[model samples]
Target: MRISDVLEKFDISSEREDYATIHDIVESGIVFKGTNLWILIFAILIASVGLNVNSTAVIIGAMLISPLMGPILGMGYSIATYDFPLLKKAFVNYLFAVVAGLLTSAAYFYITPIYQAHSELLARTQPTIYDVIIALVGGLAGIVAISSKLKGNVIPGVAIATALMPPLCTAGYGLATANWPFFFGALYLLTINTVFIGSATLFTVRLLRYPIRFLANESQKNMANRWVTFIVLLTTVPSIYYGYVLVQKENFTQNANNFIQNESFIEGDYLLKTELDANRKQIRLIYGGKTISEEEKTRLSQRKNIYGLAGVSIIVQQGFSVSEINKELSLSDRYQAEINRLKSELSHNIQQQDSVIKAQKLGGQLYKEIKPLFPEIDYCSASKQSFFVTSGATRNYTVVVLGSNQPVRTNRDLARITQWLKVRMKSDSLKIYIEKTAI
Candidate 1:
């Protein structure tokens, strides 16, 4: 009934599996050959497809079946037990699994017509502190499950949570597309997962006092500890920095949104569209209804600091006059008619309170109509954008931005989409922009 006795009742030592059994399980999972190699290939391909299509269910299914956890666990266990031969074997097999996974997924991505980077794929590219924590915790859970008397669904859940397969597939995607940023980012994430998971296993093994397979002198032990420490530090510091960057981005976005919402109305003009680029620390504000003066623009830009955006650059663009348009479009009669019609429509839309609503409705219709024709496009949005022209003039154009899961391979494909949007939307002066979303 004492506190110490009560705590003793919750001890995991009583439920621990034999050391020999745990060792056998870890060792058996290390080799990448025959069934294991085939399974890994299939899993990587499935994950790649899932990422290409942006299917969460499919990605989870792939993770459940991945054999990547085996070699990682083997490395950790071998290192903890001072079994150099087993460590060497595990390291070799781990390399084989990584190479196999990368090659298989890369081949699949290369052949697939839809090779856009989706949200799911992008999610893996940036490894943050949260990912590191998940991998470490997942590893601890996995080792515990394997060494426990009652093993259930923990291993599969750990595999899914840790997400060993997707990052590898994403890296392969980068390889296929020759996108070095995507490749390095995803590879960095995979490395973080691997190192932290192995580190976690090592920690748990030491805690459980797993018997060492070989004896080592003081110098050897010190050398091994130093190497492990170095590896852990190398993997962890970057993730911490990435996590900080992620936080800064989120804060910037939130602050930018606040600034836009609060300062959208400048004198008589109204905000038509706002484009925020967190990477460049730039905020582009497009206004309509009335032209804003230099004084008004300066006032608006100065307000960014109130919303915690001190260093952010603000570019303000306002609606242009019909004479400005006439001067810019010194072309055929057809082009003149198109510009005149666009001007009329812009005037009417600017007067209406539901211009945003109309834009949203048009976007939905565009998406519905375009989805079947362009299966690569994941989303589509139609908006009236005030473009800052090279002639120091701003012109309003109906911009249809298509978020494609794959890259728009050629100018012809973009032209086709642009033509289709013009006809469907009944606007001759419409512009088309394709933004890569996923792969």
Candidate 2:
């Protein structure tokens, strides 16, 4: 058997549906009214809620049910076939759907009590070159699925992979919260997804040799081609810049991590935590055991260049103590400084004592509230804990410790409990630890 003959066995032409059937399917989906409009609205709301609470399952459900793909696919198909009327209709309906989705999600976010930006919401606020690739590949897969006789689960999978709805909802979130950065970032990401997906569809449609509906003269064809090219380029060039920014951020983070893990250590003080802020190009190190001298800090900062962090700033903070204060002061000055330190320590001690008492009371109240829902929970306690975060800062989190007979095995159950705690406590920075008791 020849190589060409063997390759022919894998040809997709045999399984493709009729061109007319494919055209009808694409055209039928372009209209966003009645069922499709309602579905898009509901999907947007669901996605917003998912982002609000950071629920992966809910977000996936929203993606699966979204009807936003129709007009995007239609736009691509019309461009490929030179169907100007269909393109206009698709563009109009696409605008309508986007407006409706944004409005619905914005309304939900504006009225919701939980206003914190969860991890899921934050994820959509940035678009990298990788997102462009996903959108393009997903568009290709979507067109192939639509053209095939046996679609199976490809369409829904493509819809989820392309992720058209979440970014829109995220932009709505930015609008409701009056967070311009979030709004603009998410909008840019949405543009990336939209432009690339449509571009991919156009490429695939041309590759499949879909019949052109409008028979035009040479001048008309050139004009139409110019418009399409302009639109694609207008959306694509910015995405390339964003992709470059993303690459720079990833490299900074990697270098910071390497420096912290291997290079950042003091001779006398013990490093407790290290925080990296890629956006600010800063690294902060916290020491607990002892104070670091200015000379040591200077030496440490000088080593940054060796780890590919020449322009990055390094900040070092040490545990506070009266003994760590400068010893060059006179006796009177030293005494006054010691007295001030004692007063500050006393005040902090009293505040910490009060916080502990309040935590105990809150823990008991939460246990009572959660007992009925999770009968397996035998004990619960809540307290405040300090930790370093990605922004080169320390944060205080409400930590809940739970003792249960059976382990919380499923992520759904864990997420449920976490969401409940966050809402009840009105604390976005909350952590839960479950300890398994012997059966």
Candidate 3:
């Protein structure tokens, strides 16, 4: 069947009369206006916190909250229905969402005390063909949900598929870190998502048989053929390039993973994370192991060349030993330094907040009762506000009591002390010690 005739049978675009200027795209659409910017910002903040805490739940929450899907989806509808003004509006709205999401996340990360990079952010920095697949699948599903009757809990599915928040957060990390690779990789992810989702939506619309009116009259159909030809050609070139690049990436990853898995060095001796940037012809290998002997290094280099990756650069660190691995696991030097810097910040803030004294008193009272019940508890020092103790089941507890006056001279004190000690020991074992109780 001819494409136009097929579309007519399907009845794709439900004709709406009030379609006007670009602004009307949002002003008239289902998505509420005026709140787009705020919603985007709020989603970014949630995403930023999620990345910092390494919490997937929070990240997904952010994705569900993101206002990004609207404008882009609107763009697809406009193009499919041949609403040029709405298309322009949708395009502009999508741009605003991107910019707003980036800035909001960047500002949050820039000011936050946390400096550690979470898995979510790191995962976004590396764009693979897998991400494109996800976006495509997500786009198709989202459109299906929008158009169909089975629209229950589509937000969760969209969260998994679209992955809108991570890239924007990565963009923020890139800007804050001044890491060009992060910046570009994140940008590439956003680009891939846009292309796939936009394409998926277009293809779905076609499948749904959306009708489009040729600007030319039926008598002038021949004249409109050139314009159609130009449009198809223009769209097909980029799509072809995108597909080719995606395929190349998949091939590279498969080859790289196979090579790594087969390598002798990887057999229970090391854990490796490989990142391949096909465009840059670079592969980064982060692995834990002892330093390779000269012979082993030579073998590795030979393997790289054999894999057609001769120009790739490698950085190897020896981290097989317990101490070295511990050091490697430590937060980044910069992050630790920042934490130390916060001590002064906390000290200053503590003086301004009255909760410090209350905290100290709680510590004192808790410690005072802890000493008498567990003989293993050790109290090395105490003041009117707080006390300290060292206790372990293996050792007799040494308890030091700190109070403004003296220890409570009653059975109530002993009972409370016993309860406190049992909780501390995580056992109900019998033990008692009346170590130095100072006034």
Candidate 4:
């Protein structure tokens, strides 16, 4: 076959869904009627459960089934056709749907026993340039597929990729957990998806030459067109700016990943965790094994620009010493003696490490003041250890407090102090012990 013939056969626009049919599909998702309302609530519940349990499959299922995309497309149709009444209707319904999703998910998360931020949930909280691209593409694909005579799985797949449900659920989790950052980020992502999807639909409708919803005089038409242009322009400006920022972040993150891979040594230290704050232009790395030397630190610092983080600051934290744990295993026969020794040494070591971490976060001046507080307290510091009991019926997060030469306070006073520390540490499974400083 000729290349022209082959191209003609695959031309999507030739077989695009007629305006009437496309309108029907978009109209179905615009209203919050009985069935749509029920489905939305159900989808939100399913998404919330998926996020709670960190289940990717369940989340995808929720996304595919969600009615959230309906109002989004409806809004686009209204904008493209210059139907002010329809636009108002669709906008209201979309707001209601968002509120419903957020409320449903938030209610679910509030009572759940699990409060941990799992990977599946965390994924939705951060919106990047890639997410905007996915959202825009998904919106375009969805409208095109809806327009087609036969839509196999294109709409469903787009729904999954765009992930409208998960972000709402994530925002709910943040609200329930009182995590403002999570709430803001997830909500921001969700808003980005919604606005872009509507925008994409408008573009597609205009391209398809869809009939206008209402007839108007020439002056009225001009005014309507001006308003549409104004709205589109208003939306486009921020989206473009945020998109640019997201692209920069994605590039920086990609380069940082590459730099880390290049720096990894097979027999030496390995990366454990990385916290990249793109806005602050800071990279924090947690490494296991030996601490990085001054020379190696300089080498890493020098390579920041090579890794696309030209103005970024780098902080590295090494794992705490494991000699105590290793040596304690060998001296198990002298368990009692070593247990006391190990506890003291471990607590001191943790204190030093904590001091260093705090220093990096707060500053060197903060580290200097920590020593003076040592004389006022009866304990050097505290170390947290978790393990199962002999009965295996329970696990304990024991907080070993290394005692100093100062007076041992009353039990009530100590209890209050421990409670204060538990709040500061954000752990409810905490148990405190005030052991005297080992000789």
The lDDT of each candidate is 0.86, 0.85, 0.63, 0.75
In model 3, the number of clashes is: 9
lDDT by residue for model 3 (392-425), tens: 3253333334332344477886677667656754
- For model 2, the stretches where C-alpha displacement exceeds 4 angstroms are 319-439
Candidate 2 lDDT by residue in tens digits, 251-367: 999988777655555554445445688889999876544668888888878888988999999998775443443443458755654454444456556777988788779889999
> What TM-score number comes out for model 3?
0.50
User: Sorted by lDDT, highest first, which candidate order results?
Assistant: 1, 2, 4, 3
Per-candidate TM-score against the hidden true structure: 0.72, 0.71, 0.50, 0.62
State the displacement of the C-alpha of residue 337, model 3, in Å, after optimal TM-score superposition. Answer: 29
lDDT of 4: 0.75
Clashing pairs in 3: 375-397, 376-396, 376-397, 376-398, 377-397, 377-398, 378-398, 379-398, 379-400
Number of backbone collisions per candidate = 9, 0, 9, 2
Better of 1 and 2 by lDDT: 1
The residue-by-residue lDDT of candidate 4 on 3-51, one tens digit each, is: 9999888777767777787777888779997999999999999999998
lDDT of 4 at 413: 62
